[model samples]
Target: MRITTETVAAAMKSALPNKTKYHFDDDLAGFGFYRTTTGTGTFFAEFRTVAGGSKKRLKLGRVGTLKANEAREAARKAIANAALGKDLAKSRAEGRAAATVARLLELYNERTRDKRKASTADGYDLIAKVNIVPHIGATKAAAVTRQEVQRMHGKVGKARGHYAANRAVAVLKAAYAWGGKHGHVPEGFNPASGVDRYREEPRERFLTDAEMIAIGDAMTEAETIGLAVDAGTAKHAPVGQRVVMSPYATAAVRLIMLTGARLREILHLRWDEVDLERGILRLPDSKTGKKLVYLPTAAIDIIKGLTPIGAFVIAGESAGTKREKPRADLKKPWAAILKRAGVSGIRIHDLRHTFASIGVGDQMGLPVIGALLGHSNAATTKRYAHAADEVQRRAVEAIGGKIAAALGGVK
Candidate 1:
């Protein structure tokens, strides 16, 4: 008899006690269903691994869970795989025995700890926790599909933003690549390999001269008379209350603006790396590896004025203790200063961009700007090309205005 929906329903209804009956599609030899005496039924595909090999059964699903056409399609694929010497049942069983994606990620993290920077490893762990592991970590590493990774990417993009979603997929791709290299997964089987990533636009924010003056003024006020806190920001404080900022944090910001150094480079700066006499920072390591940061007089003055609290130039509360550490971040002080200065939509990193813009405005040349910013790649500093063009345009405009004025003082 043919194993269609109606026949399966009839078989389930007429099933006898303490007995089992098997029915199959006459047109498709391997596609069939088995009904138990208790009235339960399951659909399955029974096929030989090869032309004359022993038979294997791959369960499609229960009758109600999977419809007739769906089961038939599944059976066809199973049979096709069997003809190719692939046993679907054995592969599924082996997948069940393989390490889960979470386990693979754990191993990947542990094995690559020494190879990755501490901050980089921490970032991977964060991405896994916040995005990846929560979604597909339980699936067997070998069985993870591209569709699953794509879904995760789409979901993250919808909830978070494209930037965050892209970061999540990037970490997943790296994890899978690492897993493949280390034999934790099949060498050529990376689920995230072909998944399309979200497009990301580079952020461009430069501080204008007026804005810079405002920020500097705000920093000075924050250190002395204190900046007023926004109403309702603090739980206990009344509206328009004032709070003094940390001297070290203010100095750190000034140094960033003056020297164009990255937040971490300045925050984690140690006394040994500084040379007051030479006006240079002998950084042993930065994002671009070992580098020399020539300091301006203003930058040197800011550093010299800071009272050393610990090994770190910018000291946190835990400075000078057994757990001596640099300042964790300058979020609070930076925010207050921006609010006081009426500046919005600016990040601390933007200060670095502002520095590059200033250098371009001065026609310092891209090479000099790149060297000062410790950019190992010329492409990175090339982002400031627009600023250089703007400066040149203004200069040409000035020359044209002079010629025009000399030609006509009548108008």
Candidate 2:
């Protein structure tokens, strides 16, 4: 039932030895409550902030910890904080110490934008919007604790997929680190730290040379690669399977395949940042927010092939409409390519994994491969640096010495 302070007063008046239900309606800010959802003294307070806004709930305290007067006082304080511009939702989030999650996200995005690429900004938005905001967005940045982070890690990292959870944590940690350095959040080691606890399991996704050849050939022949629908044909996929692939798609996919530049980088490419004649594509700001990527010959060829007669290399295939251009999924083309190549369960991103593997197979150094991939750190590159089991075993069982010894007698 709906709760308010008057109902809470009535429940407290009828209280017995067990935890009792209470409600409070403060400031027409809507109604909230104090009750036990599962019984046995575990109290929860649920409420709505505005007359028609969403209903939000928070855990108040245990039976002994919260008396009616105590709950009433707490509610009063919350209302006061809200009136004074603090949010209880934020309170339930990070605890009671630092900045709120919302503020941190805002700061990070604002500071990183034109300073970085549109794609980079978009990526941060996705991760924050999906993982952080829904769970702990309201939490105060300073109030977030190690235990809270651990619980979160368990949930988001889920049972077997820890990579995404780890990434989300990394983003938070980086934010905190930045916060401390710049006086955004208090100075302290990241709450998400401690490798032994939140450590991630290994994930492998790389293609062999044979697999690469097959997939590449398949992609070249696939009928329906994704592209932004030009204006005249917004509702339907283009009549012709191939529309010369927009300058963006052509250069972007080629670049993505060759150098594995994030899709955002390709979407936001500007002519001024490239020097086709000099074979250099300059990134004004990287994810690290420092160091421009210097594209070598092959990457240059991909960019060279992408010359939009106007701004944005892809020139956006909106067909001259106000609506934003649609991203090319490559799903159909990817599926066809995979089927033709007899491969399954691989993603376009794996093509990036392919780039790293091919580099490793060619005996190129790890650091060189990373630099080519535009990774700012060795750690990021190492994810793709791991060779397949067969490949690794091939190195150990070369039989170079033994073959030479058997031939040595002949020699």
Candidate 3:
């Protein structure tokens, strides 16, 4: 029977239960309405591709939403397009294949898992979770415009500061590049490219001699009185209870100051990495790759005094019946030490700067200091050139005074 307003209305009202009924239009082939047992009806278009592909069914809309005349017109156009070599089914599939930003990030993470270090991978993942995913994760990779990325960069910079904003942009750039390379995004499309990165000055925070002494004294006092209770099982101490620092935490802090190593480099140091016979640390992997850290006698003494608890030098509290893993972080103990020393507005990394400052004051050249600090680039060592200039000034003054004295103090 022909599908018209009368027939469609009749079908909707009298369609049998637990059965589906199809009413084909005598006027147009493959244009029809199928009524389900529950009296719900939908108009659909069915056609084969010009290349003689299998028949495909495209749902136009529900009976109430689309009249029979509108459905027939849509079906006519669909059939015409199919005959003109357009594959509607394939087009729909390609639309689904356009990956979202979240999907691209996942692919990027998987691609770099083996190549990137655990810390580096964690940093990238954090940028995605904290910055990118929260804002534009659902947007299609190809649909993310450069203007959107620039706006996000600006917003993050205003809210969090330039450094964090630059980092977020860098992570997005890398992810988009990876997505493009892997065909997850459109070829030659990168929304993060060509955006200007904010200018960032190198930050150096060096500790003064008195500050170092105060910190040392505080750390000593902390170790002497601090408890090493198992955090997993121990009850919370009273509000006013005097808490002590962990021996491992104290040693780690001191080692960072003495050795000029990064916090992670010290915390992640293993027993196998220490060379007591040569008084050096042979790190197989570091930020600057393989490095040999020469230990001063004081630093060696600290290392010698530490009792190994697990694989790491700074081992965490043991889990029930299982060996403990490396300590995850030193936030609490570092805070306590800083508070006791009455020091504020300093980071653990500043201890490294302090070590460099001392070397500079001792008249060591920048090249030598750079080598000791495992700096891969001379440009990085150039930050200490001003300290060397101070030494040069003192040397020139002393020589000029001696010359004047030799000339019978003429001036």
Candidate 4:
């Protein structure tokens, strides 16, 4: 008999205490009313998503909550979807799994963690926590629009500066691309694409000879006499009348100035990577892949002075643990040293630029400077060409002066 209100009510009344009863609609193949032995009646739909596939039973509300006609329409839609080879239950489950953008980001980070470098993974996590998630995390992953992403980019650019905003968008783009490819969101969907990036001016600031002298003096003071602060008298206190700095951090800075190596390269340096006899570092991996850094005598001396702690040359706090890690950063020690030196607007990275600029000012050829800096591309070293031109102009001016004086004497 057709599962109408009358049939469902009759089935519920006739449902034996020891047995269950079911009534199917005459016109609809899979729509039915089910009565349990406890006399509770519910509407249900049963169908196979594919031919010969296992049948799926979907509960369509209780008898009184949903009239028979209402349940029949729902069953018809579900049956039609099943005929199109769509698994409604599975689709609903997947939608719930990545319902929100925050959930999607969490899945993206967890899945892609092993594929990225530790530093890169950490940067992505920071971008999500500090930038991306806070803005659009509550939005549905499937419903995020290009307009929303563009708006987010604009806000970040205004608040955090262009470079930081650009980095955050880059991570967002990667996350969306990964989600689309992996079926978390709709395939070929990416809201982060085509968002205009803010224009960024590259930093050209480098230290002069006087500034270098000041920094050197500061380093000496930190290692020996200790820099004076306004707070307490503790040896390692950040706020203290006199704070003696970490020897490892001081050495790391000295190595950066002398060797022109990147910050991470020095911080993550292992003892096995050092070749003191040859005065070179055999870095297994760097930003530019495997790198070979030739060390001067001064850099070698700094390395020799350091006491080895476990695997890393510049020892982090977890140096002796089973999972030994490199020094997380050089921010604190660099700040103290800069304050003591009375230097402003000088970043740690500027030390690398200073090394290259000095070489160029001394008339070292661009190719030689490039090689010393481990630059794979000659074009990257071209920024120092102006310094070389200045050196040439000075040489010509001196030559002209001497020539004019000799000519006057002869006359």
Clashes of each: 0, 16, 1, 2
Which lDDT values do the candidates have, in the order given?
0.85, 0.61, 0.82, 0.85
Query: Is candidate 2 or 4 superior in TM-score?
Result: 4
Pairs in clash, predicted candidate 4: 232-240, 232-241
Candidate 3 per-residue C-alpha lDDT over 65-120 given as tens digits, one digit per residue, 9 for 90 to 100 = 68888989988988888988787656754753677888888778878888878778
**TM of each candidate vs. truth:** 0.68, 0.49, 0.69, 0.72
Model 1, runs deviating above 4 Å: 1-103, 116-119, 129-148, 154-160, 228-241, 403-411
Per-residue lDDT tens digits for candidate 2, residues 114-151, read 76567667767777877777778898777777888777
Best candidate according to TM-score: 4
| C-alpha lDDT of residue 211 in model 1 | 93
TM-score of structure candidate 4: 0.72
**Local error of candidate 1 at 36, Å?**
47
* Local distance difference test, candidate 1: 0.85
Question: Per-residue lDDT for 66 in model 4?
Answer: 83
Better of 1 and 3 by lDDT: 1
Per-candidate alpha-carbon RMSD to the true structure: 15.3, 14.6, 16.5, 15.3
- Among all windows of 10 consecutive residues in model 2, the one with the lowest summed lDDT is 240-249
Better lDDT candidate (1, 2)? 1
Task: Give lDDT: candidate 1, residue 165.
Answer: 83
Candidate 3 runs further than 4 Å off: 1-98, 138-151, 154-160, 194-196, 226-238, 317-325, 409-411
List model 4 lDDT by residue over 17-113, tens digit each. 5666777889999999777777777788889999999999866667786888899998999899999998876776467455788888889998999
